[model samples]
Target: MQILIAGASGFLGRRLVSHLRDAGHDVTPLVRRPPRPGEVRWDPTSGVLDATVVAAADAVINLAGAGVADKRWTSQYKQVLLDSRVDTTRTIARAIAAAPDKPRVLLNSSAVGYYGDTGDHAVDETAPAGEGFLADVCKVWEAATGPAEDAGTRVVLLRTGFPLDKDGGLLKPLYLQFRLFAGGPMGSGRQYLPWISLPDWLDAVGFLLERDVSGPVNLTGPEPVTNAEFSAALGRVLHRPSLLPVPGFALRAAVGEFGGEALASQRVLPGVLVREGFTFAHQTVEEALQQAVSSITQ
Candidate 1:
């Protein structure tokens, strides 16, 4: 299988590329800068991608987008978040549609944020979308992949959860606080955090690529932990005591509207993937935290 991956330099993207390559798949990364050894340059912002790159690929996994939680959600940054996802997806969809030999599968990236604050509700692919800025962005983002689907390609939208890795994503900030012995629960500490370990996330992506699955599939761990449980698990794995608690008001004041989403409850499960017999490499929060923290320290 020849796979072309956008955002191949990002945290998850880098890992995904390596995983695909290790599986004996011919991997070509779509980078923004000059072509590195195995990378191919394609500027999604300007909609300038190499035709040769898209034409020769069996699948195109679109992960190109600005970081949603990278900055404080100022009004401008909010627009940047929405436009980055929608525009990049649209660009890739158009390019895929125009390609002579279109890729068989279009694995577009999405988030669990599409379900918004589902308090204790088990959301499957059949669940209707929730409402919010991120939800709206995801709705449009997924819809943007229509071009590829219309072009007779199977489109798989991965509604990813909080990918657990010590070096990046949500874990980085938590690790800093934990190193200082100040890491604890956030807000009420009751919000259900649907999370996935990096290895499991990569495996899920590979499973989707190899299978005949399409539409929105929740790429998350089967065991959903609350914010407090997650913090305690991380603290236990690091052999550190979690003492500090971040108040809801502080987060709200610091991040504005976006903070609410972070604090809200969402107990999501990967029903579709599990039903389809996808086995998780790391099933529990404790096992995931141990591996993630150990990897960083080593």
Candidate 2:
């Protein structure tokens, strides 16, 4: 199968590309700069994508978006977040719609933030949209796939949680801190932090790519843990002591509204994946951390 991916240079996209190639799929990266071998350049910001580019893909995966945690969320950066996701998605959706031979699947990215603070409740894909900055962004971000869906494309929204990659995702900094014996819970330590091991996430994506699945799929682990639980698990994996906790006020002051994301509770579950018979290799936080540690060591 031919897979066209936007944001292929990003953390998750980079790994997905390698995994897809290993699985014998032809992976074509859509970039903004000069095209590399087997690559095509498209400018989402300028809204300049060739129709031929979109028509060639058996599947289209749009992972292009501003990093939610890249910088402090100022009023301007908030708009940047919205445009980066909604605009990029719109660009690809339009291409898929206009293409003569439309792709069979359009897997657009979203986040568990769509459910906002779910407290202790484990909300599934059927739950209603939540509130706040990240939630609002997710609402618009997922909605941008309307064009492709209307054009008879099978659109799948990947409402992902925190991806646990040793090199990049959420584990890198935490790994460093654990080595220094400074690892600790943030805010109240009661908030849920939905997470998935990178390898497991990659496998899940592969399972969905070929299967007849559509609509929103929560790309998270089967088991959700609290911030305190996550901190303790990482510490145990690294043989460190998680004795400190960052206050909610301090966090809010440091990163603005983005801090609210860390402090807010969201115990999300992969309801769709389980019902579809998707198998997960890393089912718990401890198992996921073990693989992450091995990845770092090697």
lDDT of 1 by residue, 166-263 (tens): 87899989998998899999998988999999899999999999899999999889999999999999999888987688999999899888789889
Query: All candidates: CA RMSD in angstroms?
Result: 1.4, 0.9
Any residue pairs clashing in model 1, and if so which?
none
Instruction: Look at candidate 2 and tell me the lDDT of residue 267.
Output: 95
Candidate 1: 10-residue stretch with minimal lDDT: 44-53
TM-score of every candidate: 0.96, 0.98
Q: What lDDT, from 0 to 1, does candidate 2 have? A: 0.92
TM-score of 1: 0.96
Task: Using lDDT, give the best candidate's number.
Answer: 2
Candidate 2 clash pair list: none
Q: CA shift at 63, candidate 1, in angstroms? A: 1.0
Cα-based RMSD of candidate 1 = 1.4
